[model samples]
Target: MTGNARLDLAIFDAVDIDTVGAFYAGLTGWDIVRKDGERFGLRTPEGQEIEFQRAPDHVPPRWPGQEFPQQFHLDLETDDPQAQVERAIRLGATRLADGPAWITMADPAGHPFDLCQADGVGPVMRLFAVTVDAPDASELARFYADLTGMRLVHDHPEGALITDGERNLMFQRVDDYNPPRWPDPAYPQQAHLDLVVDDLVTAQARALELGARRLSAGGERYRVFTDPADHPFCLVW
Candidate 1:
């Protein structure tokens, strides 16, 4: 993997699988790739991956002993943030925040995503990478290599980190990585990460078998699903 890497955020949570699928599939143009009872993936023209998890009836987070700070957020880049925000809202992304610095919205599953103005280009944004969110660092790191047909690069026992032949992403670990709440009048979900794939159908199926929770979001040539951890990410072709 090179130093330059684009981003496809992977958010964690235990929420409705189809709900998340609708969130991302509506926001990004990623098509549904595979489908199972629970797990699935949204495919782009290329093959990137995101997923959701169905936890054991989890509870939503409350920071400040009442309202918790947003544990994590997906950062998206675009030429026009305002236009994108409008599109997201129209496509079902609930507006959590709308500020000049950034616009925060949620997927169907209630994860926060940010459409902030680019902070220039980071050391790893010019290339391609799929950001993964996971509890186990080692397992996800290895998973990226296998999934991307590449090898592991750096080792971050604190979290999962991997790289494809040309790009890379950090499998971030958050002790309080409680996914945001969606559909709540008080606080809605923020944003979602998008992925790309070569073949939406095959990739979506593969993801489902790997423990992804499929959503009702179906595309003629793609699919969408959530991973075991409940993070909403997608694959595209």
Candidate 2:
């Protein structure tokens, strides 16, 4: 929390928890470590975890929609993009498009993810980055860099990337992006990050200094706040 904060989770809010959990577990060969009626969690071989929570009345975001946009997307790394795309399709993912360096696809719950070809990184599918949509990529990246003390690796008009060595976070420029209304299902939070910190009060103060707006002060070990781009994230001890 003081020196380097770790990303604990990349969570998705899905209509069917089991379906989404199964899709990611099969897609990544990760173990579904936690499962209940309301929540399903997967622990990757590398120890990374992604979870999906039940939202019966969830309305999936429409891609390229200004009204209800995809707030974020997961970037998966693979040595063979084509084979991974095929495998994803077999596991209930819908191929959206294939870019020159990445293939865009949606999971069973209609959340978009990218399968990017890696340069001899590994054959196993791995979560590379969690890209968040923002009004200004560079600005958002700077905010996170200050908050986490991470380096700003990439800076561009289209997008900007930041990393804390262990995890990568990207910010993509989105025109007329609408910030999600916290606790309001109308503007649902499609995805969110859980950052681990040491002290709540000290970390919260540092976060606010870095432009994080406190949304809620609930829970004994966690608090909810919105980033400069209005993406909700939790600071947990």
Candidate 3:
């Protein structure tokens, strides 16, 4: 790899990786590239892949569930969302909201996602934009932008949006973002985001200063931390 990772994915965790992977594989015609019990990789027709990890304490999000809000979601490119929703409904996905241009929905695992039309060309295709959930929209955006050398690309009702080179992330605001259930609820988020940082140590420090909870510390080159929403993110070398 040159400097940054080649691609990014807006992932959703599931209790059963096979069940979840089957749903998506059927939808996109993607096949499994690698499966090692806990982790799976689904490759698109063009060779792009999406990974899903089997979580130990994976809790299927309850859409209108107070404790589990829609944090990160996938955006699929489909010509007709209505048609896709109809089909997905039969396959265990539910419609959260639908409009002419876009439709927000949930997978069988209760993870949120969206389906929209693609508006790009050739190999430079734009899939779904990643949403970064936060309580203090402005603060989180600034922290992430400063840490990643990215720019505040835009703003929205829930929160702000930012992009670093090819990486596009949306910040959505949530009320009372009490992190993960942790050792108590046994519903630790099985999924996490891998963020490339300039300096893993410095980035970890900065994140901690911003209320990020350190999950594990030590010999590994990366550090894991929980966001205000209880979702885990990694500071990768």
Per-prediction TM-score, please? 0.46, 0.92, 0.76
Better of 1 and 3 by TM-score: 3
Residue range 45-141, candidate 2, lDDT tens digits:
5677888988887778777676878898989888888988889999999988879999999999999999998877565577788899998999988
Best by TM-score: 2
lDDT of 1 by residue, 40-68 (tens): 56654445555665543534433223254
* C-alpha lDDT of residue 53 in model 1: 50
> lDDT winner among the candidates?
2
What ranges in model 2 sit over 4 Å off?
1-4, 121-123
Clashing pairs in 3: 180-230
Ranking by lDDT: 2, 3, 1
Q: Model 3: per-residue lDDT, tens digit, 1-237?
A: 212322244445677777778787776566778777877677665554567887656776655454765556665776556666788888888888766788878877778777786544222223445666567776666656665566788765578876765566677777766445544455555355766655766777777776678875535677667765567766777
The alpha-carbon lDDT assigned to residue 87 of candidate 3 equals 81
Model 1 TM-score (2 dp): 0.46
